[model samples]
Target: MHDPLQYEGRKVVVTGTASGMGEATAQILVDLGAQVTALDIKETSVDVETALTIDLRDPASIDASVAQIEGPVDAVFSCAGLPGPPFGELDTMLVNFVGARHFIEALIPQIVEGGSVGCISSAGALGWQEQLPILMELFARETFEDQKAWLEANQETWGWSGYLWSKYAIDAWVGWRGADLIEKGIRLNCINPGPTDTAMMPAFHELAGKEVIDSAIGPIGRYSTAIEQAWPLVMLNSTRMSYVCGEVLWTDGGFIGANSTGKQGGFGEL
Candidate 1:
């Protein structure tokens, strides 16, 4: 059978692989015959070529992990994140966007031409477009410290929902930086997954009542599985998706479409 995804023997890096979508993505990549390097703050059970511990909230940790990774990577699946609450808002933003961005930027030189980067954003970032002005301002700061400082200084603006704002930043960064990466023969894209059933689900439920969480579900009528979310992310970074760059694939079972059309209710309403 032809390997349409072209992952066989490919060198790929997957973050947040200790559990949830990251673990699912790593397992799937391994099964597809890719050489997977799994990374997370905790140990991952996934059978990969390498498993490294990484703290996405710290630039030093991210840099250390990158140094350990053998380069000429074919793809990167950045799935690490925090659900907020137990973790502080700033810490959440650091792991979700700031640190993640720093890690990816560090790997850019090592990524082979045509390599692709796939990130996991959130459906909660529905109105990200409206927040672009401020997001751009945050992006203007080049260094990790500078961006972190900017985020720290602008807390009041996005502190209300670090998860939402971080997801918003992810969506924006994919489009904003993707344009530049593609010129180097690399592609960057992300998936804004709706509610997914993962270890992190309970945290979200605790933060924003179960009723509200369920309301975000579209016609799908249920939360997505880790693998369900992982598939689109894997596909987004596949060689086949060569032309698809700087795109946000809403892996929400029609939630975005339905919400946009006013057919889906509850979440994303004006």
Candidate 2:
């Protein structure tokens, strides 16, 4: 339970911090003495006093907020995410993957050597690596507006699949950064948590119903409390995992071994 990585007075930026893994990660870092700036879409009055309301889907917002941040950073935990449904397919990719990349590109320079950029990717992103070429093609077009235009054009048809593609793209990025991060003496890694109990768990439960949620993940038979995942998350950001880059760590309990499909584990019978 004791985290050896000391964070006293270090600057750390954590996204999706209003709640869940993001919130837990930031709070733990703060307790370890890190000066944490937590970013999220919605606002909350409690928890860490340092917080920023951000919509990663908007390039201007990413630009503006990141621009205001001053000085060298110890780490960047890009944890902002969207599941599906509300944002549909295309929009989900735009925010979770593309927008996350945008924030990284903007802030990477500020992270000093020995710094880290960690993310919360999904275990569902497994075997999705085959689409990396298509994802690179999308990023080649660059510019959030251009990507947005492409999404608007193809969304009516391909949007749903685009979300999956975005996560896949992120999976590829993890490997790409592994080599690149070492060159700069920094590190990059990702965590793919299984079904997690968070602010959004209830929403997922409502949307999919127990038949789906119960069978989809958490091979150990229950969703991981946000805290369960944050420890490893913080460890990855620590020197302990500094040599670990371009790797995807699955902390979803035993879901990857048990749930071949992202569908809740109990659903095959339904």
Q: Candidate 2 at 144: error in angstroms? A: 1.9
Q: Please, what is the TM-score per model? A: 0.98, 0.88
lDDT of 2 by residue, 92-147 (tens): 88778888888887888898998888888876676766666666666675678887
Model 1 regions more than 4 Å off: 266-270
Assess each prediction's global lDDT (C-alpha) against the native: 0.93, 0.76
Q: Estimate, for each residue in 1-270, the C-alpha lDDT of model 1 and write its tens digit.
A: 688899999999999999999999999999999999999999998988999999988889899999999889999999999999988999999999998999999999999999999999999989899999999999999888998999889999999988999999999999999999999999999999999999999998898888888888988778899999999999999999889999999999889898888797848342
Roughly what TM-score does model 2 have, to 2 decimal places? 0.88
Q: Which runs in model 2 stand beyond 4 Å of their true positions?
A: 1-3, 45-49, 156-158, 161-163, 259-270
How many clashes (backbone N, Cα, C below 3 Å) per candidate? 0, 7
Q: Which candidate number has the best lDDT?
A: 1
Score residue 181 of candidate 1 by CA lDDT: 96
